[model samples]
Target chain A: MNIDMIRASAARAEGHVRRTPLLNSHFLDEIAGRRVWIKPECLQHTGSFKFRGAWSALSSLNPEARAKGVIAYSSGNHAQGVALASKMHGAPAVIIMPKDSPRLKIANTRAYGAEVVLYDRAGESREEIGAKLAEERGLTLIKPYDEPQVIAGQGTTGLEIAQQAAEAGIENADVIVCCGGGGLTSGIALALEAEAPSFRVRPAEPEGFDDAARSLAQGKIVGNARPLGSICDAIVTPQPGDLTYPIMQRLAGPGLVVSDDEALQAMAQAFNRLKLVAEPGGAVALAAALFRGDEIEGDDVIVTISGGNVDAEMFERALQTRG
Target chain B: MNIDMIRASAARAEGHVRRTPLLNSHFLDEIAGRRVWIKPECLQHTGSFKFRGAWSALSSLNPEARAKGVIAYSSGNHAQGVALASKMHGAPAVIIMPKDSPRLKIANTRAYGAEVVLYDRAGESREEIGAKLAEERGLTLIKPYDEPQVIAGQGTTGLEIAQQAAEAGIENADVIVCCGGGGLTSGIALALEAEAPSFRVRPAEPEGFDDAARSLAQGKIVGNARPLGSICDAIVTPQPGDLTYPIMQRLAGPGLVVSDDEALQAMAQAFNRLKLVAEPGGAVALAAALFRGDEIEGDDVIVTISGGNVDAEMFERALQTRG
Candidate 1:
């Protein structure tokens, strides 16, 4: 899709979602040896960027389809996003979530007035469960990343970055985004490619789950070999989506990965300097920005802190982590 | 002194300090039973609003004083603000800090290239030390809250709030401010009185350290009966400043106070829903907003999350606090 579609999606999502703040820090800048601007999605509705695409998808649905409701599968962020968006639209949503997802995430999702169906991650396929739920309930299945509307909705972040960067007098920036299934990364890449060609989007993932990095390097879609346990649960999708992969493949630069420890350190630094509560998974881009500064070739960099739905225990541990 | 001065300060301080975003939360709105717009000063430079007034004070100084340098005494935030601002303006800064201040705060102030002299809180008066140093060094004393330029600098935040609230279509609001010595509160009150008179400013303080609240009620400055061993270290000033007390006395509504436990709860809630790391003092306004919803008379409310410079252990404890 073109920038026009993304702009239209931003217009549609306007007034429904928060225009989250863009923050700058001289301390972070000193560490990166460049001007570091941060877009904290932790402040977004449901504490993540998922709500952007969720609002886009649900709002795009026809009145009949909206009344019938929608179905989604997520570990946490996406579930809450979809639930809150659906509720705001007076529609019902059923979310198929992994049984092992963090309790805080599950509670937040339920608190948003959605029916949550917990399933075994190893035994049940979320896509299949979502499809079944949609068929059984006469609801539309809203794929988290593969849909155009969702991608367009996520592109609104790119539009905001471009607009905010321009306001800050920045013409060139290396944008680092936390990647799960390439939805946020690809959408941002497309928007930047259209609006700010001088700016580049770089995706960062956890060490054992760098599917996006592998896929970008090999010129094809790639999948993680196994679901290695990690603290960064938010961006551990097995593979990128079909629609999101191509845009990311075309527009994104070399990808980056950080250890879980590095992510924890990033979270702590974010709390100390930026005063934003970022979950370990949400801090991947910050980890990359802090550790992989040699790879950045721009005078300015934008790091996306994509989520903050971390449990209290985990957040406390993150706060105690030292770089 | 007025909106014009506040506007000029906003303009003067525009490029020096960040125009921190004003955030709106439906979740917070639900809790308050009104439109809750949050102006989180926790995101400002030096992780607090002190930087604003510091910059205004140092920048407005005469060439002779600016060249000679400046001196100040503060627990933490104001020290960092003055040090950074003085460094930026090519002036030397001597900061007198309490011996037992947070190690993180001491390290941060020194990181900005200031001479840090720690004095025993129980033995020495910071003001006397600061005055003595200013004489020996021929340095200007930048009082934290008692000066006009500093107050004007703090007023920049008020101008931003008024401008941002207007953009959000909020005409009248009960603006809750975390009160220390009334610098920020009085500055905001002055600005709001001139630019957004329908909107009222209310000062919120931690229990046992509610000197501002007591002084406002008595129509005269009143110090705490005893040294309050409070968790809200940032706002534990002896009493309101002579310059700040009058403005707050005339403009602010009846003040509110929250217990230390309530402050911690507010910090936890801010972390979970607002993705902000607020110190105990910084959170008093939010604590009032969350627990004292009955006192708010307007349809819209704005609460300022003032600072986020808490120690890691304290933040960890706050996260574990369930309310």
Candidate 2:
């Protein structure tokens, strides 16, 4: 919510989190016609920046509350983040996932020592199931992005970006972020506003599932008509969060959109040039940075590969894009 | 070389070289049956630790010598490393590579601003061509390994490992390294012997191309009868270097070898669990750690993924090994 709170979260999360490096390649620069810097959160603890927020929220809980347990509903990166964070904290977590979720994700979440409860996506309401389960098990429900602590946790990434940019001799540039419900985008926008005001944050979304882009354009929350069809399944929220939209509206630049193919091509580029694996959703910001360069200004541009949890088949397809 | 020389190289290469992070995965630990820490130089600039040595050798040169540029003979990682480093230092580089080398490697080396000269592996001697070119162009020949400054540069990796292990609370462990002409392995051995005495360096090689292992067993340098057949071409050298053999004989532990299949499997595991791209040769140390656990001791082990320059087809083959 604020710089102080984000700094506090950073303090709480220090030593527990990996300070991932800021990666760059001249090959990527050629594509964008400018110097391109990548903050590869794909190399983070849970292969995503979500772990920062997860650890922040879980660690801030009272000793007794943490001992009781926590619960959340996510089928992908957030599920794995909360699972690993809770396990590391010596606490239990119950993740409510749709039964139709990828088996690899469900298996990965469980492998991290969390209890996964699957419900039918068409027939069951995750909220009702989550609320009942939380009540029955005395578990705290950790919202994926809406809560203040979670946003502050995600904001810690922005603090790192500010410092890393300074280290890279970058005074001003647009910081592109992959956006789902505006949690990461808004958090980074707030942190950079306080710490590196010359730097601007821009939300990047996959086309056809670009709720964040539409919302920012209209100066209000707008819902996507079809969110389930995008290959960037990791970031397909129906609408921007009420809490995060205002922060993004006030601090962020115009949102950028790239097609799923662009995301795949970006994934291939990350793999070939930077030697980093990036899931399609995680690669959307990089895709925008490379393919939507006209909309992004400055001699330098920084973007985040927010996650790298794609399945093998999807990754193979990405590699084929380059071929 | 001594620790002081390595220290000087580290200082010279400080801002230019990326201090790649030490990454870990609990899943890798479970498979290895012990704690496994990964020093992923695959994330280094140029996607390999060769850049460290390249930068060190180039920067250590006198202004006049460096201005005349440099030459090296390598068809893969080392060629790219020297090219990028020379380019960055405002110096030209001439790389002599085999005509049969992968087109991707040849193209990448040239793209880094180096002039590539192709010679037939079966018909022409690269060393003779290299010597003629260096003498004619006034170019300093930077050997891929077996050179004092180059070894000192590679030794910087060991210095980082010692510090990172100390931070991770590891007092004693086997530090596994992929071995070629023993530049990296011997350099790390000499370094750990001085800095972290409890840490033992072990050379890892693909089976049948185990010259380092056979040499260490016989207490002398031994050449591989056939070195051109292995998929792990990155770390396949005919014999350990004269300069590096003595250092390894004095400070390194027994060498370990893994099958090419195992190396591919390790590469897949790196992709799945650590979100890292590990070419066949780079994955050998990790393969030995995970699949040859009986040859190692103690509760902890460290391994390096030395480089990641595999072409798309090779990486796909690695992915298939897991399936």
Candidate 3:
């Protein structure tokens, strides 16, 4: 929630988090008509920036609480993040996931040493299952996005961007982020506001699931009509988090939206140019930087490829897109 | 080349060369049955570590000679590396390549502002064409390997490994590298010998093109029967280099070789576990580390993915391999 909290999170997460390099390509610069810098969080442990938040939250727990265990409800990136974090901490974890989730994700989460409990997405409520389990086991529940420590953990990425941008001689530019419920977006906005005031955060989302953009435009939280169908399944929250919306409204620039095709093209370009595997959701910010350059200003732009946990079939489709 | 020359090259290439991170995955560690650390030079500029040698050679040139121009004969990663280095230095580059080279490589080299001169690999001598062009245009011919400056440049990767190993508390381990003409292998050997003598260097090559291994076993340089056709085209050299062979004999351990299928499987594993795109040639060391672990000793092993310039078709094939 504050710079001090983020710094403390950084202190706690040191040695655990990978300091992902700031990647760039001349080809990407030409496409954006400006210098394009990429922060590849996809290379982070658990293959996403979510590890930062997960570690932050887990590390902040009191010894007794941490010893008891933790529980989370996610079938995707968050599940893997929390599972790995808990495993590293030697704490047991129970993850509530939809039975219909991708087998790869389910296997990956279990491989990280988490006990996965499956529920019917249409019939059983994940929250009810998670709450009952947590209460019975005396386990602490780790929310995916709308948590103070988690936000602080995600903010560590912004700190790295500030340092990396300085190393690249970039003083001012827009920092585009792939937004879901706004954990990463608001966290980065807060970090940059304190560390690099000249830089602004801009949320990027898939067209139909652009609740963050609409929320920012309306100066209030807005909900998407449908969030489950976007190709960018990694980032398809129905609305902005109450804790994150105000921070983003106050500290971020306007949000940007791109189509699924644009995200796929960005993924192809990332694969061909940067040699980084970026999932559809991860490529949205990069998609905006490449194809929606006119909406952004300044000579330099920094975008994050937030995650890379795509199935081979979807990655093949992304690779087949025009680069 | 000695460690001092490598240190000098690192100094000259500072700011221009990327300090690629040492990436690791728990999954990869489990498969290798040891802690596996990956130095992804594939994420380096121009999609390979060749950029290090290219930039080092270019930056070491006298102002007049550098301004005159440069030329290189390669149809793969080396071509793109030299092209981009020359362009960055504001020097003209004339790249002589085989007409049958992949269209992506040719186009990518040209996109870096180099003049691509296509020749028949079967009938004509690229050396004669390159010599003629260099003489006519006062262009310096930059050899792919066997040059002291280029070897020193590649040695910088070892210097980094030495430092990174210290940070990781790794004092003794086998440092595996993808080997072609032994430039990278010898360079790294020399660097580790001087900087971290406890660490050993091992060269990894494709099975049929395992001349480096055969050379080391025979106590002399040996040539492969055929090198023109291999899935690992990037590292399919006829034999070890004259300059590099002696260094490898003195400083490196025994070489390891992996089959094409093993390399493909390694690439697929990298995509799944590390989110890194690795070409077959680049994945050889990793392949050896994972599939050939019985031959290697130690609780920790470090492998380098030397490049990521594989074509989309090849990448798709790699993705299809069983994880």
Per-residue lDDT over A1-323 for candidate 3, one digit per residue giving the tens place of the 0 to 100 score: 78999999999988888899999999999999999999999999999999999999999999899999999999889999999999999999999998998888898999999999999989999889988999898999999999999999999999999999998999879999999999999899989988899997999999999998999899888899985899999999989999999999999869999999999999999999999999999999999999998999968999999999988899999988885
C-alpha DockQ for predicted model 1: 0.79
Instruction: Point out the worst 10-residue segment of candidate 3 chain A by lDDT.
Output: A219-228
Worst 10 residues of 2 chain B by lDDT: B314-323
Q: Which stretches of candidate 1 lie over 4 Å from their true place?
A: A99-103, A119-129, A136-138, B120-125
Evaluated on CA atoms against the true complex, candidate 3 attains a DockQ of: 0.93
Per-residue CA lDDT of model 1 for B1-323, tens digit only, reads 66676777777786778888888666777777888888999998889999999999988888889999999888678999999998888999989888998787788898887899999989888878877888898999889899988999998889889889988899879999999889999999999888899998999998888898899988899999767688998888899999999999899968989999999998998988888999999999988988898888878989898899888889988887886
Candidate 2 interface RMSD to the true structure: 0.7
- DockQ of each candidate's interface versus the true one? 0.79, 0.82, 0.93
Error of 1 at B322 (Å): 1.8
Q: Model 3 residue B100 lDDT?
A: 94
lDDT of 3: 0.92
Enumerate residue pairs that collide in model 1: none
Candidate 2: C-alpha lDDT: 0.92
Candidate 2 per-residue lDDT, tens place, B240-280, comes to 99999999999886999999999999999999989999899
Best-matching candidate per DockQ: 3
Docking quality tier of model 2: high
Q: Considering only N, C-alpha and C atoms within 3 Å, which residue pairs clash in candidate 2?
A: none
